[model samples]
Target: MIKWIIFDAMGVIFIVGDDTNDLLVPFIQGHNKRILKKTINEVYLRASLGQITSRQFWQEVGLGAQYPQIETVYLDTQLILDDGFTSVARMMSKQYSLALLSNDVSEWSAYLRNRFAMDFLDVFVISGDIHCRKPDLNIYKRFLKEAGTQAGECVFIDDRCKNLAVAKSMGFKTIYFVRQPKKSDFVPDASITSFNELENAIENICQQIIERVIFY
Candidate 1:
């Protein structure tokens, strides 16, 4: 049976999953017309990997002296919680341990969690804190270490299939989260278009696990 439920921060908990595409890219484009999206992406990745400080990220991205504004004007004002997720999570928390696995800047992750009041989470393995990002294998290892559970006992939910690919390889049961369903080549153990559907999908996975153990 799954004991821990690990959710990705961006898309899973927050409404915007791909912050580079949804939040950062547009912010950069609007603020600095000369910086290419490629530069923004690379610098962002460095920040997420803990290779650079949050202040340095802004400076490198041509937003020097703007980290304070960013916390207020950008992330604080823009990042939104997924509607109805907190309620569902409260109910689910009684049944399973909830944790977070995210690729985010260290300071940004903490601020976001505090802003949204994610007190329900017990473990948070953030890339910015650990110097490793998803799909690299080490990040997931860090999660398992921090969570004190094996991959099989955890259910990881993410909006990005590539991150899920690595988790699946590591023996994690994955649920793909999408705002809306579309034809996709990649498949996960379950899929949900909305947060309200999560409990049912998790229950279904648990049931399957029980049945498999019975059969064995």
Candidate 2:
């Protein structure tokens, strides 16, 4: 039975517009712009797992070079939806322990910390402070150990399949977040496009928890 729930921040809880790509990678040639060798997925993995510094992560993508001029635009790109906060907070509070595990930049993350009273969370693991990123195994392991919860007792939800795969291998039940069909490849216990879907999933999972206890 799940007693705790963890979430990935960027795609799952917030939506960044197409301009994110432009802000992240600003260089363009006369006709074509260079593509990133390491996808955002890879960057996030490294960041969340604490494998690289924020500077190092952005430098690899050529964005670090122009960080000074574009920093504001880059940091301001993130948008936190009111509906998402209402949904996730409603389901995860009181009944279940909730944590946010995210790979994020220090400056911007601090901004969010002030904007939202995420103190409601039982725990929050952010890459910038810890110098660890996701899919590294260590971060997840540390989170579980420090969170004092067993893998089977927790559910991890992320927008990427690879991230979910890693979480599953570590014994977490995972949900892959899809923006459109609300489903993805790895058969999440539940997949949702909007935060509002979290209430139903939480209720359903808690019911299963009750059933299991009763049967046992």
Q: lDDT winner among the candidates?
A: 1
> Model 2: per-residue lDDT, tens digit, 76-156?
544554456645575567788988887776655666756666776788877766776676777788788779989888888
Error of 1 at 97 (Å): 0.9
Which residue pairs does candidate 1 place in steric collision?
A: 11-17
Residue-level lDDT tens digits of model 1 in 1-216: 799999998888887777787788888778888999999999999999999988898889888867678656787667888888899888889989999999999989998888888899989999999998888899999989888899999999999888888899998999999865556677899999888899999989999889999999
Give candidate 1's total backbone clashes. 1
Candidate 2: which stretches are off by over 4 Å?
Answer: 17-23, 26-70, 78-82, 181-185, 212-216
Q: Which model scores highest in TM-score?
A: 1
- Candidate 2, poorest ten consecutive residues by summed lDDT: 23-32
Task: Estimate the TM-score of every prediction.
Answer: 0.94, 0.71
